[model samples]
Target chain A: MSQNVEPFKGLKKLNRKLAKLHHILKRDINISTVSTPTNNLVLCNSGLVNGLTEDQVFEHFSKHGEISNITMLPGKSCCFVSFSKKDSATSAYECFNGKLNISQNNRPVYLSFVEEVPKPSIEVIWNELPPGLLVFKNFISTEEELNLLKLIDFNHEQCGLLKHRLVKHFGFEFRYDINNVDKNQPLDQSVPTETDFLWLKLAQIQPEFKGFKPDQLTVNHYAPGQGIPHHIDTHSAFEDPIICLSLGSSIVMEFKKDGTHTCVLLPQRSLLVMSGESRYDWTHGIVPRKFDIIKTKLGGYTCLKRTTRVSFTFRKVLSTGKCECFYRSKCDSFLNCNIEEKMAVQLEKMHVHKVYDNIANHFSNTRHKPWPNVMDFVQSFDSGDFLVDVGCGNGKYLSNNTHTFEIGCDRSANLIEICRNRKFEAFLTDCLSIPIRDNCIDGVISIAVIHHLANESRRLQAIQEIVRILKKGGKALIYVWAHEQVKNKQKSSYIMQDRKNRKGTKEMNGQCLTSAQQVSLDSGNITLPVHSNRSNFQADDLLVPWKLKGDEEENESVFLRFYHVFKEHELEELCLKVENVRILKSYYDQGNWCVLFQKM
Target chain B: MKLLTHNVLTSKCIRGVTVGYPLLIKATNVKVSEVEFKPDFVAKVLPKIEWDVLANAAESLGHWQNLPKELPNNYENDTDFLKKIHRVLLEVEVIQGELICPESGRKFPITNGIANMLLNEDEV
Candidate 1:
């Protein structure tokens, strides 16, 4: 009869068996204990705490009200601590162990817990009592979700001291969305996919984060001398306990406790669960500096090497309307108006320096020699000005410096060493994690660095770092490869690669330029092979037509296309989103876009 | 010659104008303020301007009287010139009058020291 059963019937039978299994578990627990209390309810099996004293453990249980009964069995290993209300039990677990570590069996053992969750209302409870705080950790998918987030732009557009809020008596600064905050589903903004599975586990442990969904995520990318200033989140937009997930690098997430500073180092991949008195009552910020070294004097871990880091700052935005206005007014297109508005406002308010502006005006005086213009630009900087040349390449700008005190940092140590060889000090550094002091520099200048970063998070972080160093009314200058400049490079990559193989064009002036001989793909899409110049293009033949893909275009008789051009309006809008860094000038010429800005 | 002004006074934007956006100013009146020199502030103003346009404007305003014809070998002694340049670029108020586009001959008036260059509804 079982063999003759249809697929539907077979499925039904499986469901029945599952139901019977649950009943058996319930019956076994019931038979073991006598006179179960009226308030008792069983937690799930197989997923229970392993070991603890009855007194110590009971304290945790009683705090959530009272543990009516406890059933423990060896081999069965799992013990049931019955609670008065299912919701109360769930909330208690979530509030206390949000950042707790779980074992291979999905059971928590380390007691990484938070206490005294701030209660805003009397309705929420552990059994009949609602805790004042909520806690959670590792809600992100390590392999899939994190990798995906890196590819996408996670910059908070709005980052600046709120002039509007200052008028209201609170010293508040915000990094909000440039696009509308309310347009997308909250879960979509915070957790892009449900398959993360880890979040489900966290939700099971802490039910507080279950109802509150995050609609946006801000990735704070900092390097030395780069940090967000002391600021309060918009109370009208989001409620307390901003959940911050630190990754890649470490930083001091400082909180102003009373008149003293209570700082905590947000270690890599760690979650900082904060709210109530810690959230609404205090200000938080990262102090700009190079490597976060926890020395004996500092009383923490040793010096942690600075790396390209990205932090997912998640918070539930309460006011949807405020977010929408800030985003739509900033983005180029009003499409996705809801999400775009919040993003725009956030980005504009965020700390973004205009490195192009200072560079552009470095030669603004027509009558003066270019040297004088450079000098004026240089002298315009302060004695202790902290300047960074993002793609300092060979530190050409630093080599030409009249000022001696500024720091010159680059991603390539070889290039920095060359600067050092030239008696111009430079260091090996990445734009994503600039090593400098917060609000310490008077000016920053970056030339052709934004394009070098492979993704948006790196680009935004680099910009933020520059902003972090400059004092109020400080200056920033940025020179970008106008979409045209990058396109030209793309074209040249192909021609140089093709010529190097000696299968395409003749060498000219001791250099070769030809189409690519290979094709490459990234995430299923065809990508133009990057010409490292060492392997593909030579020093002599710097200008050549190149395709994004390796050899596919040459074989298909397709002309390699350059893909980084920005229309004037789009560039203008991009500049406007940088808060405090007001757009002063945008120039389009010579296959590049130059922009200037100042901190307000 | 603020970058903000330079951006709005482009040659093509002037209806009835031809070219040479970023006007080449021939200043009849000039003023310099002795404001506290803020290097960061000056650095912030750098990007919004066209170097060549500002150079020409500085020359026309006589602010380049002390500056070099090109970038100097060393810029240390150029503080006075820089301050003058800063005053010209950021502080000098041009409260009354108009900026005539050199190419288009279209007048973009400076009323209350702010240029009014709003295009006709159809010209956006």
Candidate 2:
């Protein structure tokens, strides 16, 4: 009786899962499940992405009758197999529905009769390999393959550094974490001397490898179940051509980019050279499976079980300082400003520079009032002394004192234009590089500027540039927005003057701003959270929305400006990093960390 | 962009450009305004100024009015020399021009007296 109940419970669970699968198929792919028998059968849990390769499904389904075609969606868990006769399809579906247990995953295969097979999103081009991907079969003799394999010396070399496969590196160790190498750290070992014979052989067969020489060689020993994750070789890390010589076995290496996926068969003793688009843009990886669906010479598909495969991947480390690959978005060298820096620049360009450019006229009108402390700093300079107000919006402080020759520079060209029209001396320049003579200016006032910088290093760099431009004994004043709006029970003007924005126009959830967008960091990935305009500071880096008011009350347009609001001691610590500067005064005034430093 | 700012500006920030200093000026619009002639300030700034760069920059803008090619020996007391240097360095400005990087030939444009020395993403 206990055994009978156990079977009933198991049947109930299977029935529930089958219902879920039915709903998913109907909702996602629009393949309606029909109770009546049809010529087509959709096998759930059996697909290229779902542990089952295409040949496995064909082999099982074709056993019932002749199969017209089998369609397996890439990166999906359902495969459609249609038979020439409806009886064959029904019989196969009857036999496999909740009965066939997949040997690979040990999961029960669910099958349901469907109206028709969903067409492949990408057209099938079996003969075509991705452009720039060249494979030369029989490039090396069997003897050369054995000799190169022997030189690897698993027992003598550092093998199995990674869990997925056994790999040995020569010249430089490829860092999987950063997807790049520390070019400075060269290994004592070099490419095996025995493989030099391939150069003479390549000259006879493939002229593409005629003049190529590689400094870095990674000998990868992949077992049947081992594979490398899909990735493009770091564009800045290596030169154009990446050559790999396969030995001992043949396997289908998957190539994918955007939405197109192609698998190329790298036969045993083949030399594969990936350059240009194939090398820099498309990602290539081997699917870790025992069997691969291979195309036969007769244009028919068959299963080729994977064997012990080994490859000698050769690459020349890019000695050139930078890579100017045409694939700008995909190139690592182009993204030389690591992801954080990229995000910073992107955030600034969209939120800061472009926003200020669009709202320059309104921004200048709202920014006429000069802080008393900054005014006093500008006036403190001696008559005829050269003073620069970095990021002087609208040049409010440019003509404050006629005794000294003051120049205003800002990142915004429109603001600079306004200053020019006012007959004041101003220039367009980013605070990161002042574009001014070093050690020439007697005084510098950078009020409410550094906070616009998106990151710590950039903000620090701006301050350092200020120090670089100031003459010895020259004083500079910097002010950044403070994290704490209310200190000592006294509310700052930023909070006191926030009466209009208190009622946010859009009812954003308190947690909405903290959307966890995964940011690829050198250390790995981190979720860089976005922040809303909240009273309490939860993050240092955030987008502060500024509503550009138009003529009408409802005509307000919002623009986000990136801000790195300073915490206590953050401003002082950054200034201390500049070796030549002495902090004259550091204080909090009106929700801002104001610092007066002199170049010593 | 004033000749004073041009004195220290360099395009070394661009990749592969080493000696981007002493940028050559090519001005379409040049303006010279009457600045308060302060001989003492000009004398102090003269030491920091790249004199050859200043002279060439003024010449390129077609505002080089009998200014000396080199800083005169002990010329701080010479009010005439100081006044000439002051006019070239501070008074004459490149309103609409380009500051061409000597090494890379990359141009930084000066529009409305503002020189945009910003490098593109690929350049950096």
Candidate 3:
């Protein structure tokens, strides 16, 4: 008793700074002001959003006295912990208030007395799972689980490398870069025969799986501190009723949508089944940590140390490679998929198309010289060959390839005016849907245009449109800005050009200094990196500044243009997503990733 | 925009508009100019042409010169008809016009010989 009594002496120091503590709590999450000392204490900077679990709070505060309840606020950075007696609460306040960092990457915990805690139906919320979610216990015996684990060769390296966890796939390899599978390229090996018991047991339990035949398997090995990112499996890539069998250790997976979330406990040897709404709408993933907070035998939460966990995810590759789910808002491949566009399209209109139109004259003046390899590609075509130049700006390459008949198209109105003035036939059209008839063109060239697209689906759609117009054996040349500026100790021309002009003019785009903007997609809203215009890249998605020699009043007016620079080999990877196209050549040019593909 | 492009430009990229081909030409100002006729190029790609749509567009623009309503047999071997086909496909241009989608009835404006097929951002 005396050992714990001495810690309360620090309470005198905390009382002097009570006013600053009150502002912090009131400013962040809306909670009542600090009152006289009581049994309830609202601890700031120590909540689930700060990576503090309920068990961590219970273990830390219970040292002072008995814990009545610990409430973890959803999507908040504060929690309310109560004690049985006021003395115990005061001891915890004195011991930790403004004295210790609650988490490894945050400020010290700020404790203040409150009269009562916000009472939510805690037990009911945790007990119920999302709609169309099911769990079966003891689906496979321990001996069978061990034998199945042995079948996984850790030395195998077929699956694409992911930074978060170890993964292996059979039957058909899953492509994480596109978040889909190559339906035409199935592996020679199929799902193992040893895991037949797991499927048979699942089928016996659920009537919907009576005739289910899973054709693909992805085995994941996760260490204690590793986790997969939150995502829903691509709807167009797989069929319904995806199932996963947990073999090694138990963990808590979070299912979240909108602002609500539910933590699900998948114990060892249990099988989790997701279908319908749960499989199509809700996103699921584990929080990377060393321990998980879960309910103990006595109905009190306790810290469960995590261990190596392995799971086998079984899915049936959709034969038609499309999902016609009734949830039209959430479905990607629904029938008549002419829905509202994504934020990518909206962003392209504002940052890319508008910017080009505004700066068409200056841009055309600066971009008169065409790259040699691109010129070579155009000259290779025979005299009678006809080609369409998608995203052709100012017709810099149109007259150079006079041997071949070519018509240009772009998304800018001002730039197309310049093309018209130059007597080059051009039109206003989006690259995603070219107006040309199918299999009619001999070649296509898209230079520094694909990077302006904000998302992968749009980029792939653009490539597919190009391939749709090319005749058999017709070639296409594509180029995009590369993120790797200095390759093999040699600085690229893009980076070297900027080095000489680093004075007086300051970048006006300060989007990166603020929080990320919420870009609303069809399924839901996601935070994308804000537009930045710094010399060094803060992220893959950024904005580069184009300063104008401005009016007499203002010295300079800077415009920020958005660009999504590609990583090394990213262009080849995107080209592989298109069917019946062979990537003939993929190389790094002066500062861009270039690819030449031919229709097969 | 050339008659060749008008033959194939579709408003189907718009939501709920399935068949946007043969966009009805509503030209306020039409222009005619001579383009270098390349017989070999026109001969190689004659079959891909939708002759009916091209004829209809030419008729609407008042540039139709007794062109057949249907694709003629052995048109690739007929050099005289191929020159006429080349003139109608490349020489006739809709300088200032609006392309009306047959299904959606949405109009895409044409200014200075360039047809704007970009969907409105709000519509998208």
What's chain A's TM-score in each predicted model?
Answer: 0.30, 0.56, 0.66
For residue A594, give model 3's deviation from the true position in Å.
12
Q: For model 2, how does the per-residue alpha-carbon lDDT over A194-225 read when each residue is reduced to its tens digit?
A: 77777677667768568777888988988887
> How do the residues A258-334 of candidate 1 rate in per-residue lDDT, one tens digit apiece?
44555455656656655555555556776555554332232212344455555665665665333222223221223
Q: Write the per-residue lDDT of candidate 1 for residues B1-124, one digit (tens) a residue.
A: 2322332234353345445466544334444434446554555444433567656666655555565555443334556655655665555544445566676566655433333443442432
Each model's total of backbone clashes: 119, 1, 1
Provide the lowest-lDDT 10-residue window in model 3 chain A: A504-513
| Cα-based RMSD of candidate 2 | 15.3
RMSD of each: 26.7, 15.3, 10.3
Pairs in steric clash, model 2? A513-A530
Candidate 2 chain A: worst 10 consecutive residues by lDDT? A1-10
Q: What DockQ do the predictions score, one after another? A: 0.01, 0.25, 0.30
Tell me the tens digit of each residue's lDDT in model 3 across A1-600.
222223343556666656665676677655675567998898865777788777668767878876767888777777888887889999988777776566546456778898767754343245468999998878778898799888886666554445667888989988653356777779888998877767667777887788777889999988898887788888888999899989899888888766567888898888999998889988999888777766544555556778999899999998886688876655656522322357677677777888899889989999978999999999899765767889999999888864566788999999999999998888999898776667768899999999988877888899999998899899999999886554444556665565442332212112222433434323334333443333334346666767776567577776667677886777898999999999999998876899999999
Best by DockQ: 3
Which lDDT values do the candidates have, in the order given?
0.44, 0.77, 0.77
| Alpha-carbon shift of residue A255 in model 2 (angstroms) | 1.3
Fnat of each candidate:
0.00, 0.43, 0.47
